[model samples]
Every structure is written in C-alpha cells, then in structure tokens.
Target: MDPKEIIARRVAKELSDGDLVNLGIGLPTLVANFIDPKIDVYLQSENGLIGLGPIPEKGQEDKNLTNAGGQYVTLKQGGMYFDSATSFGIIRGGHVNVTVLGALEVDSEGSLASWIIPKKLVPGMGGAMDLVVGAKKVIVATTHTNKGNPKIKTQCSLPLTAYKEVDLIVTELAVIEVKEDGLHLIERHPDTTIEEIINQTDAPLKYTNVKPMEVKS
Candidate 1:
C-alpha cells in the first residue's frame, strides 16, 4: 500500500463520530477521503466554513466554495459558512474538537515546526499556530523522515507553531503520543522494531505499553 494512504488511514481511524475537525493542507486534507462513510464527522476549513465534503466529481467544481487546500468541495447538509473572522473565532475559541496538521518537525515536548523550509522556501506562517493551539486535540500527521533524516527531534530546529500543543503524531513508521513530560513511542509500524525506530529519530524518546499501529485484520 502507498505510504500516504497508510498515513491517511491511520489518521482516519482516530476520528470519532460528530467531531468538528479542521484538516490542514496536504496530508491532513487526505484524511477526509479515508474516513468511513458510516462514521459521520464534520470537517471545518480555516477559510470560514464547516461540514465540508470531499472533492466533487470532475466537471462539478464549485468556484464559490473551496477548502483550505484550495480544492473544490461539496458542502454536506447543515454545512454553513461565516466570515473568516468568525471562523477563526471558532478555531481560536477552542470549539474545534480536533485538528490534523502536517508538520516539518516535532520535538520531544510536542512542539511543531512546519512552515518555511529555510532560505525562503515559503512566505508567511499561516493558520498553523492557531490550529495547533486552539483545538482540543492536536494531531500531527507527517512522514517520519524528510530527505532521509528523522523529522522527530529532541528540539525543533525551525520556527515553532505551538509549544506542547500536539497530543499525538502519526507517521509512516510510528505513532507517537506527546505528553507534557516527553514523547511516548506508543506504537511503531508493523514491521518496525523499537531499536530501529529509535535509531532513526534524532532525539531520545520513551516507549509506551501500547502495541504497533497496523491495518486491522
């Protein structure tokens, strides 16, 4: 299976019915496609709306409505749009149940560093700082490695979005639970060994009692 698909599936499995979730661009956006149809979850976009649907069929684009990812989406029944200020109020007021954001780096204390690749790769820090801090649960979804190096570190080397806002991280190779004290390596990839996962990470990480994250049989 594709690694991105695995990450998406793993993320989708964590969702509870009736959650008002804000999904960031990129990998966070993919979670919508993987959510079980039987499980009804409300998707909120930072652009001032809630109850977002997945991408529409080709030739059915709705120019007036788009997601934070800039993709056209259908609004589910009862979906509503407000001003951007109100939308941010909902996010900043902590009414959001969960937020799934893509991260460039996450530290032992659950700090996230996502914007800017350095040397001006991107301009401006977006809604990340708010989403990570405002949501009741902040979950980061990203690959374990970036350009063959561990993205989870002892300390973030880049600018931070929020300190200790991340509750958990789902990577291609492991699922890490972040606590106030430190990160707990709660689950590794099905084939991954604890030693292997540790060696790949640049920081010291403690392990939890939970087993690995796997595709349910």
Candidate 2:
C-alpha cells in the first residue's frame, strides 16, 4: 500500500468502540475511510459535524454536508449538526476521546508545529490548538520525513501548536509514543529497517519493547 494509506490504516487501530474522535485536515482525514464498520466511533468535524462516515460515491455526493477540510462525506446514523460555536464547545469541553492530526514538525518533547511554515504562506491556526489541548489524547499522523528533512526533531524549529501535548505519533515507517521519559518507538513498519528509521529521525529514540507493526492490509 502507499505510505499515506499505510499511515491511515495504522492509526485506525487506535480508535475504540463508541469513542468520539476529531479528525483534523490533510492526512488525518484519511482515518475516516479506514474505521471498521462494527467499531462505532463518532468521527467529528470542526465544522459542526459528528458521526461522519466514509466518502460517498461520485453520484451520491451531498453538497450540503462536508468535513472541516471541505470534502463531501456521508453521515452515520444519529449524526448531528450544529453551528461552529457548538463544535468548538465540544472540543474545548474535553468530550473528545481522541484526535488524529497531521503535523509539519514534531519534537521529541511532543511539541507540534503544523499551522504554518513561515517561509510559505498558509492559513492561520483554525481549531488545531483547541483540539490538541482539549482532547483526551492527541495522535499525530504524518510522514517520517519531508523533502528529505527529518520531521521528528530534537526540537521544533517552527512555531509550536502545543508543547508536550502529543500522546502518540503514527508515521509511514513507525509508531512512536510520547512519554515523560522521551519518544518511545512502539512499532516499526514491516518493510522499513530499524537503521532507516534511526537515520531519518533527528531525535534520540527509545526502542524498548519495540515490535514490528501489524498491518493486515
């Protein structure tokens, strides 16, 4: 499978039945496509949606419904819609069980830098700050490197979204957990070598109890 799909599939494993999950834009949005049907998790959108489902077929698209990324989506049963104010309240109230988001850079300290690049223009922080802090747990889903530069760094060089707030990180090649001790290597992609991950990571990694990632597809 491709790297993006690999990362998304792995992250889907983290969701639990009946959990309320907030999926950020970009790669994080792909997680909605991989959620198991039997695992009843509510996929929330910052744009006032709850219980989002997989993308609809071309002819089945609904112009009135979309995710925070502005992509058309199907809603699961009991899905509810409200104004943006109510959505922010849900995020700020810590009612979300888990949040999957993408990051441009993440430090060993678990600080995330994603809203801007500074060198290039992009939209300012929307609801990312609130989601990272208010969610019970935050999981970063991103690639291991960007333009040959290691994204997992000793310290984030860009402006941070949250400091020491990330709970887990799932990349194309590894699954890392952020702990008080440091970044812990929990799972490695089957095709990627340990040395490759070591060479591509800027921060010191703890490999205690590390295991090969079990991806069914």
Candidate 3:
C-alpha cells in the first residue's frame, strides 16, 4: 500500500464511534475514506462543515462544496453547513471529539510545529491553534521523515502551533503515543523493524508491549 494510505489507514483506527472529528488538510483528509462504514464518525471542517463525506467523484464535484483545504467533497445525508463563526464556536466550545492534523514537525514533548517553514511562502495558520487546544484529543498524521530528515525531534525548531497538545502520532513506520514522560512507541508498521524505526526517528522512544500495526492492503 502507498505510504500515505498506510498512515491514513492506521489513523482511521484511532477513531471511535460517535466521534466529531476535525481532519486537517493533506494526509489527514484521507482518513475519511478509510473510516468504517458501520461507525458514526462525523467529519468536521474548520471552514464550516459537519458530517463531511469522502472526496467527490471526478465528474460529480460541486464547486460550492469544498473542505477547509479547498478540495471538493460530498456531504453526508444529515450534514449541514454553517457560518465560520458557528463553525469556530463548535471547535472553541469543545464540541469536537478528535482532531487529526498533519505536521511539519512534532517533538517528544508533544508540541506541534506545522504552520510555517520560516522563509517559504505558505498559507497562514488556519484553525489549528484553536482545534488543538479545544479538541478532546489531538492526533498528528504525518510521515516519520521529510526527505530523509526525521520529523520527530527532541524539540521543534519551528514556531509551534500548540504546546504539549498532541496525544498521538501516526506515521507510515509506527504508531507513537505522547505521554507526560515523552514519546512512546506502541506499534510498528508490519513491514518495519524496531531498529529501523529507531534509526529513522530522531527523538528517543520508549516501548511497552510494542506490536505490529494492523494495516489493511
């Protein structure tokens, strides 16, 4: 399976039934496509959407219906739209259950730095700060490395979006839980080994009952 798909699939398992999930742009959005149909997971978009469905079929795209990332999406049967204020209210008022976000870098302390790369021009930080602080749980869905460089570091060098706000980190190589002590390696990708994961990650990882992730093809 594709690495991104693997990461998305693993992240999808983190959701529980009746979760009001806010999926960040990029890889995080792919989680919607992998959610179990039997579960009641309502995908939320910071741009004012609830009950978000998977990506629309190529020809069925509705220009007016887009997620926060501007990707065309289909709304579920009971989905509804609202203004940005109400949408943010849902986030800030602690209505969101889980928020899955992608990160440029995450630290051992569970701090997130995903908004900017300093010199590069990029979109301004959207609702990430609010979502991280407000959501009941925050999961970061990102690759373990970037162009051979480990993204999980001892401390984030970039401007942080939230401090010690991340609860979990799901990568193509492993599933890590962020605890008060530090990053915990709970599961490794079936195709990877502990040595490989340790060598690729910059941050130190503690292990307890580590198992292979159950990734579907």
Candidate 4:
C-alpha cells in the first residue's frame, strides 16, 4: 500500500462526529478519501466555504467551486459561501476541531516548515499558519524523510508555520506526538525499528509508553 494511504487511514481514525476540518493542499488532501462514510466530518475551505464533500467525477467537475488545491469537490446540504478573507475568522476563532496538514519539515517543538525553502523556489504559505494556530488539534502527515534525510528534526531550519502548534505526526514508519520538549514516539510500523527511526531523523526523540501501531486488514 502507498505510505500516504496509511497516513490517511490513520488520520481518519482520529476524527469524531461533527468536526470542521481543513485539509492542506497536497498529501493531506487524501484524508477525504479515507474518512469513514458513517462519520460526518464537516470539511471547510479557506476560500470562503464549509461543508465540503469529496471530489466529483470528471464530467461533474464545476469550475466555480474547488478546494485550495484546485480539485473540484462537492458540498454538503447546508454549506454556505462567503468572502475568503472572512474565512480566516473561522480559522483563527477556533471553530475547527482538527486539521490534517502536509509539512516539509516539523521540528521537535512542533514548528512547521511548509511555506518556503529559501534557496529553492516555493509557493505561497497558504492557510497553514492560521490552521496550525487556530485548530484545536493539528495532525501532520508526511514522509519520515526527504531524500533519505529525516523531515522530523530537532529544530526546524526551513521556516515556521506556527510554533509548538502541532499535536501529532504520522510518518511511514512512526507515529509521534509533538510535545513541548520534543517528539514522543507513540508507535512504529511492523517492519520498523527504533534504531532505524533514530538513524534517519535529524533530531533526538523520546519514547512515550510506545507500542507497535497495528492495522486491521
């Protein structure tokens, strides 16, 4: 299975009924594909709308409405539209229960590096800054490493989306909780070893009553 699918499924399990969630543009966007059909998680978009549904079929695509990633999506029955600027009010006001975010790097303190990569060309910071701070719980879903170097590090060097705002992080081999001091290892994938996780990460990590993360086939 794809690593993203694993992360998506795991993120799905964190949801409760009636959550207002914002899925960051890339890999995090796949969370919509994994949510249980029975659970009604209210999806929100920063571009002035809430109650977003899943993507529509090719022919059903609508040019007017789409997610931040520009993918066409459906809407819930009572969903409404407003000005994009006002949407930040909902984000900063703490109405969202959880946010699934994609990150370039996450530091021991939960600082995120998503907006810029100084030397390399990067796009806008988007709503990451607001979601990290405003959402009650922040969940980061990304690969353990990029180019074989760990993306979860001791301190973030790229940039900051928000400091110490992240709650949990899910990588291909590990599931960690971001804390004030550093990461607390909660679980490891079946074939993964603690040594392997440490060797790949650029930062030090701590263990927190850890056990293996299991999945039901």
Candidate 5:
C-alpha cells in the first residue's frame, strides 16, 4: 500500500465507536476514508461542521461547504453546521475526543511542528495550535521521513504548535506511543525491518512492547 494510505488505515483502527474526531490537513484527512463503515464515529471539521461524511461523488459536491483544508465533503444525516467560533468553542472546551494531524516534525517529547518551515513561506497556522492543545487526545499521522530526512527527531527544529501534546504517532514504518518514560515503539510495518526504522528515525526508541503492524486484508 502507499505510505500515506498505510498511515491512514492504521490510524482509522485507533478510533473508538463513538469518538468525535477532527482530521487535520494532508495525511490526517485520509483517515476518514479508512474508517470502517460500521463504526459510529463523528468526524468534525474545524471550518464549522460536525458529523462530516465521506467525500461526495463527482457532481454531488457542495462547493459552498468545505473542511478546514477547503476539501469538499458530504455531511452525514443529522450533521450540523455553525460558525467557526462555535466550532472552535467545541474544540477549546474539550468536547473533541481525538484529533489526527499531519506533522512536519515530532520530537521525542511529542512536541509538534507542522505550521510553517520558516525557510519557506506557507499559510499561517489556522486552528492547528488550538486543536493540538484542545483535543483530549492527539494523534500525529505523518510519514517517517520527508525527502529521506528524518521527521521523528530528538528535538524539533521548526516552531512548535504544542509542547509534548501528542499521544500517539502513526507513520508508514512504525506506530509509536509517546509516554512519560520515552518514545515507545508499539508496532512496525510488516515489510520493514526494525533496523531500517531505527536508522530512519533520529530519536531514540524504546521497543519493550514492539509488534508487527496489523493490517486487515
């Protein structure tokens, strides 16, 4: 499977039956496509929506409504729309159960840096910082590396969105849990070697409970 799909599928399994989840831009948004149809999770969009449904088929999309990333989406029955202020209030008030966000870098301490590169100009941080601190649980979905450079580092070089706020990290190669003790390696891609994961990650990893990644056929 493609790396982004691998990460998304893995994260999809982490959601509970009734969880309210917010998907950030990029790879994080892909998790919605992988959620099991039987599950009853509610997808929240920071752009002012709750109960977001799957992407509409072509010609069925509502251009007037979009997610925080501006991607067109369908709304599930009973879904509600409101102002952005209300959406953020739900986030800031700790109503969101989990949030999956794309990260440029996540350090050993679970610090996230995904807003900007500084060297290159990008859009300002919209609601990412708010989501990071507001969500009851945070999961970072990202590739292990970018252009062959390690994104899981000992320390983040970019500006941080939140300090040690991430709870879990799902990458193409490994599923890591950020603990008070250290970065714990919980699972790895079946086709990837432990040595390969270690070499590609700049941060030291604890493998006390490591296992092969579980992928449903």
Candidate 6:
C-alpha cells in the first residue's frame, strides 16, 4: 500500500463508533476512505456537511456536493447541510468528537503549525484554529518528513495554529502520542526501525508500550 494509505488506514483505527469527526483538507481528508463500514462515524466538513461519505465514483460526483477542500464527495443517508455560520457553530460549540488535520510542523510540546507559511501566497487559515480548540481530540496526520527534511521539529519556526493542542501524531513511520512530558512513540510501522524513525524526526521522543502498527490490506 502507499505510505499515505498506510497512515490513513492506521488513523481510521483511532475512531470510535459514534465519533463526529472533522477531517481537514489534504491528507487528512483521506481518512474517510478507510473508516470501517460497520461503524457509525459521522464525517463533518467545516464548509457545511454533517454526514460525509467517501469520494464519489469517477462519473458519479454531484457538482453541488463538495467538502471544505472543494473536493467532490458523496453524502451518507441522513446527511444534512447548513450555512457557514451553523457549520462553524458546530465546530465552535464543541460538538465535534475528533479532528484529523495535516501539519506543516509539530513540536515536542504538541504544538501545531499548519495554517500559513512565512511569505508565501496562501489562502486564509480556514477553521483550524477553532477546530483545534473545540474538538475533544486532535490528531495530526502527516508524513514524518517533507522532501527529506524532518517536519517534527524541536520547535516550530512557523506560526502555530494551536499551542499544545495536538493529542496524537500519525505518520507513515510511527504513531506518536503527545503527552505532558513530550511526544511518545507508541507504535512503529512494521517496515521501519526505531532508529530510522528517531533519525527522521527532529523533535525528542519518549517511548511507551511501543508496538508494530497494524496496516490493513
């Protein structure tokens, strides 16, 4: 399986049956594709969707239906839509159970920096700030490195979306839990070594009940 698929599949395991999950754009959006069919997971799109389904088939996309990222999507049975105000209300009101987002940088303190890069032209900071603060749990789904540069850093040099808001970090190489002390390595990918993961991460990490990650075929 692809590395991103491996990460997404592993993240899918973090969901509970009744979770109202908000999946951020980019890599985080892929989590919907791997959720267990029997579980009652409600996917929430910040743009105004309540019961999001997986990506639509090639020709079956509803032009009017899209996620916060503007990707065409299908709706589950009882799906509903509302205005942006109500959508943010759901986020700000703390109704979301878990939120999975992609990060540009994460620190040992569990801080996330994903909204904007220094001087680059980019869109507004979407709902990340609100989601991180409002969601009961926050999970960051990102690769360990970007173009061979470690993204898990000793300190984020970029602007942070939230301070000490991340709960977990899932990468292609490992699953790390953010604790009061620091980032903890709880699960390692079956194909990688601890040394490799350590070498690829710039931040310090602690180990606890470390086990191999379960990747579904």
lDDT of each: 0.86, 0.91, 0.92, 0.85, 0.91, 0.91
Number of backbone collisions per candidate: 0, 0, 0, 0, 0, 0
Candidate number achieving the greatest TM-score relative to the actual structure: 5
Error of 4 at 116 (Å): 0.5
Can you write out model 3's per-residue Cα lDDT over 1-217, one digit (the tens) per residue? 8999999998998889999999998899888888987889998988889988778788999999999989898899999999999999999889999999999999999999999888884667889999998899999999999988999999999999999999999999999999999999999998899999999999999997999997893
Stretches of candidate 1 above 4 Å error? none
Looking at model 1, report the run of 10 residues with the lowest lDDT sum. 208-217
Q: What residue pairs clash in candidate 6, if any at all? A: none
User: Model 4: residues >4 Å from true position, as ranges?
Assistant: none
lDDT of 5 by residue, 101-210 (tens): 98899999989998988869677889999999999999999999998999999889999989999999999999999998769999999999888999999999999767
TM-score of each: 0.95, 0.95, 0.95, 0.94, 0.96, 0.95
lDDT of 1 by residue, 23-129 (tens): 89988888888887887799999998898976889999989989886889889899999998999899999999999988889999888999877786775677888
Model 5 lDDT-worst window of ten: 208-217
Residue 56 in candidate 1, Cα distance off native in Å: 1.4
**1 or 3, greater by lDDT:** 3
Q: Which tens-of-lDDT digit does each residue in 1-217 have in candidate 4?
A: 7888878777777888888888888888888787878978888898888988878887998899887778788888989888877799898899889988988899888888888888785787888899899999999999889979889888888878888898999887888998777888888887789889889888888995678765432
Better of 3 and 6 by TM-score: 3
Q: Candidate 3 — number of clashing residue pairs?
A: 0
For candidate 3, the 10 contiguous residues with the lowest summed lDDT are 117-126
Error of 3 at 65 (Å): 1.7
